[model samples]
Target: MKTVTNISDLRQQVKDWRQQGLKIAFVPTMGNLHAGHISLVEEAHKHADKIVASIFVNPMQFGENEDIDSYPRTMDNDKRQLIEAGTDLLFTPTPEIIYPKGLAKQSYVEVPNVSDGYCGESRPGHFRGVATVVCKLFNLVQPDVACFGLKDYQQVQVIQTMVDDLSMPIDIVPVPTVREASGLALSSRNGYLSAEEKAIAPALQQNLQWLAQEIQYSRKTSPDHSPDFIGLAKKAAAAIDATGMKTDYIHVSHAHTLQPASEDDKELVILAAAQCGKARLIDNLQLSLA
Candidate 1:
């Protein structure tokens, strides 16, 4: 795959592709290549004629105490994986290339409401960094379609809201979360887990699955009664903590708006974040009551 680091060179290549009438698909990621990330590129291959994947460990998206400096950067491996996954072009822009005026002076994008709770609440200014950098990448890549993993459900929602509100012509595709056979959702942070912690990691997904099943069973058996979502979330969080992980937040919300799930809401999602050793892991499950 052709790798370009500058904006002008990247745009020129995209322009050439546009002139050829080739549809483009984009996948933006931090530089830790894994099976989960490759899955995104594979999904992109189905939607467009050429795939454009970017690896910019966005400093804007990371918080003050977050792992920006220590975030994994496996460039040689990442390039090999992308080429194997059929990525046509790789855009590896430096932070300066992305934010010429510096982050303090850079223009930012914020999608209100959806970016308020869950991870947003846990990490202030996180979504602001996410929206702003994603907005910049969307502008630079200008692909017809972009694929994002549903493992980061709120992030997908925030980006979707941003694109719709801004009238950007890019289609946002939500790909399913790829997991290990043990049920652990793959994340770069997973590398931080000790062997003991790795064994406990699958409990996060298990708790979410259990919560989904409980909600489903409650709806089926007690059609007239509203399920106690807040209580269920608390129970799940407690169960996760019982497994030696510290719960950050476990919430049930409307799938679309991300507001607290009400009795009348048919489409719902359960999101959870927990600290397992040095790694902070997040996972979610969506339910369609309709």
Candidate 2:
């Protein structure tokens, strides 16, 4: 695999590869390569002749209080994994190379409406930071297809909206979430979990499970699937509390819109976020009352 560390080098390399009639696929990630990221790379390899995976832990997307400096940087090990995964080009660029002017003064992109809720509601300007950097990467790599993990499900939606709105040609492909057998979502933060936290991390998944189970339990007794959305939200909140998590917010909402749905809307998602020890995690489960 070619390890590219500069803008011009990647541009020239991509140009040469395109000249050889190779189709390009890109997977943009922050460096903490795990099975989740490798799964995306594996998906890219299935279709594209060349896969260019970037490892830029974008500073723009991180908040002032967020774990930017503390974010895991396992580059030496990451490179070894990408090589094993059949990645063709590894674009490892600096912040200045990406943002040029840096984040505060840089031009940013935002996807409207859909970016208003879920993680977006809590992390103000997060999607703008995400959308901006992703837009920049799309221009830099100019891949025919860009692969992302479904682990960041809402993020994939926001990015797709941005691509369509701006007429970016890259197709956004969503790969499923890679999980530990414990049912905890595989994330870089998982590394920071204490043994006690790790033992209970599956509670994040179980909270989602509880939300689905409660909604169905209520439905079966009512003979009507339309349980109160606010009540269901409370039930979700209670389930999260039962997990010993400090609550963020919980909702049964339209999976696509992420707007809180009326009770009558049987198709929804149980989205929850909470703090577990030093780490904050989120998980979601789809619930369709039939």
Best by lDDT: 1
lDDT of each: 0.94, 0.85
Residue pairs with colliding backbones in model 1 are none
Model 2, 115-208: lDDT tens digits are 8877888888888889988999999899999999877767888998898888988888988888999999998888888998888878777767
Error of 2 at 83 (Å): 0.5
What is candidate 1's lDDT per residue for 23-50, written digit by digit as tens? 9999999879899999999999999999
TM-score per prediction, in order, is 0.99, 0.94
| lDDT measured at residue 128 in model 1 versus the true structure, 0 to 100 | 96
lDDT of 1 at 258: 97
Clashing pairs in 2: none
Off by over 4 Å in 1: none
TM-score of predicted structure 2: 0.94
Model 2, residue 151: C-alpha shift (Å): 1.6
Candidate number achieving the greatest TM-score relative to the actual structure:
1
